[model samples]
Target: MPRNYASLADQSVFPSISDLPGDYTCPETGGGVFGCLLVEIVSIERITRLVLRTFDRADSPVTVAFYTGDRGRSIENDPKLKPGNTMAILFPRRHLFLDGTVGVRQEHYGYFKV
Candidate 1:
């Protein structure tokens, strides 16, 4: 997996993440700003080239797991998923948030192509 700590920390587009908005929030957990902090997918070719970025930060040992969908299971697990496709990720944050912390919890949602 590729890490983008320097780029995420510097708020710049590095090899790790990109195409992030200036002010973005998690659609699910409403957490802090998420940039291209992760390396989501690698190409299926011989070199395993990458095509997607994640919201996870560098220095974080990450794993990319795949799931197969059974009929009538869930929208995400649909069997019609194509190769090099994208999906939305929603996660929560405890500290720094795009929205102020109060009764308002923080969550983030973004697309990761596989």
Candidate 2:
């Protein structure tokens, strides 16, 4: 992921959480990069990686997961990742999981700003 991925991303082509395709039951690859999403974090789960449940600007429920491959174990205890704080997901893949939930799955670094 580039540092300026979000700034270079075209919003019309790659939209926000609210504009994601409803029929996408599986993961699609034209990943979007949101510079910043001032979401309301609901919970924080850290076992092997960092997972956050949040509500986006449209009040749509979402899950943001950062794999530990890039975000080391120390990120689990980061103070900035607490519930209610803002997080940014850049160049992340949009995933509609089997549970019928929409989310951003970041499998690498340089894509998250917490």
**Which candidate leads in TM-score?**
2
Distance from true position, residue 111, model 1, in Å?
Answer: 2.3
* TM-scores for every predicted model: 0.23, 0.64
lDDT of 2 at 99: 63
Give one digit per residue, the lDDT tens place, for model 1 in 9-110. Answer: 463433222233223445565334553333333222112321122233342222232222222123334343333443333322223222332111212112
Error of 1 at 34 (Å): 2.9
Which candidate has the highest lDDT of all? 2
In terms of lDDT, model 2 sits at: 0.64
Q: Where does candidate 1 have its weakest 10-residue lDDT segment?
A: 101-110
Name the regions of candidate 2 deviating beyond 4 angstroms: 1-15, 20-38, 70-72
Q: What is the RMSD, in Å, between candidate 1 and the native fold over all Cα? A: 13.2
Per-model lDDT:
0.30, 0.64
lDDT tens digits by residue: candidate 2, 1-114: 647443425554444676553334444554333334445678987765677888876678888776556555667777787787877665444577666778876676566777
